[model samples]
Target: MSIQVGDTLPDVEIRVVSNGIEEGRTGPLFAGRKVVLFAVPGAFTPTCSNRHLPGYVQHLAQFQARGVEVMCLAVNDAYVMQAWAASQNVPPELLMLADGNGNFTKAMGLELDGNAYGMGLRARRFALYAENGVVKALQVEAPGEFRVSTAEAILEALA
Candidate 1:
């Protein structure tokens, strides 16, 4: 089953670029914090690049004003995520995490098969509001839908 709002986030290894290359765990990242974690199917995809990611980047300060750490996650590798962040010119405060092995995505039961497009296993588009490692709210979109996971929607929910 997919993770529910009341579920504690599972500890899964993910990658990030810091100093050089580094591996980190979700549990530690969410520990003692309120996080706005959003996932996309892949990096550099049209919808993801143009809309999804830009929404977060644009409304980042609003999230932070509410004491939320904004994060963008995808099933791509650390290198790809890092490069995408740079290309998007995302602020440093927004965390870009890579679920390269799909471990975190599978653990959350959010993995999507994109083999038809040769993308392999990837994350479905979704967003979660988590606090202290426990999920407070979760919004998952239907396939090819981008309605509820947008930054504006989540910000409205918070308000």
Candidate 2:
């Protein structure tokens, strides 16, 4: 089953580029803080690059104003995530995380099989709000849709 509102996020290893690519875990990242993490199927994909990520970038400050940290995740490698972040001019406050092996994605039951499109296991387009490691809200989109997982939608959910 997919992770739900009361679920404590699985502690799984992930990669983030801090001076260089470094290992981190989900549990500590979400512990003692409110976080809004949004996942895309891949980095630099058309919809993700043009719309999904930009929405978050534009509204990042608004999220922070509510005491929530914003994060963008993809199944790509840490190098690709870093490049994408630089290309997008993403602020340092908005974390760019890589789930290269999809361990965390699978653990959350949010893995998307994109073999038909030549993409491998990937993360479904979704976003979740958590407080102190416990999920408080989740919005998952339907296949080929991009409706509920946008930054505005999550902000509305928070309200």
Candidate 3:
């Protein structure tokens, strides 16, 4: 079933670079924290690069101040995620997680069909406020829309 507002996160090893150094076999990234996990269609796509990711990147400090650990998930692999992170000038802290096989995306029930666009599987734009791995607020956008899950909106939820 699709994960909902109160759903606890699945314990999956979503590949992540804990810092710039990269890490181990990977583990559940949100076992004990308040996390703002957002998913995008692809890494480096114009809207995701210009809006989705940067909105989080620029207001990272604001999120931090509110005790939100922001994470970005895309259907690409770790290497691509890392390269894109570097290109976006993301700070060391904002985690870029690779949902390479779309396992987590499917698990969360948010995969999008982009076969016509040649991307195959991807994620819809959405943000969830999770507390200790359970979602508290969920904001999912209709295809091609960006109004509801912006950083400002998530911050409002936090408030």
Best candidate (score: lDDT)? 2
Instruction: Note the residue pairs that clash in candidate 3.
Output: none
TM-score of each: 0.97, 0.97, 0.93
Candidate 3 segments exceeding 4 Å error: 21-27
lDDT tens per residue, model 2, 42-127? 99999999999999999999999999999998999999999998888888888988999999999999999999999999999999
Evaluate all candidate structures by whole-model CA lDDT and list the values in order: 0.92, 0.93, 0.85
Candidate 2 or 3, higher lDDT? 2
Order of the predicted models by lDDT, top scorer first:
2, 1, 3
Candidate 2: where are CA atoms >4 Å away? Answer: none
Worst 10 residues of 2 by lDDT: 14-23
Q: Write the per-residue lDDT of candidate 1 for residues 1-159, one digit (tens) a residue.
A: 999999999998888653345788889989999999999999999999999999999999999999999988999999999989989988888889899999999999999999998999999999999999999999999999999999999999889
lDDT, model 1 = 0.92
lDDT for position 78 in model 2: 97
Model 3: lDDT of residue 3:
86
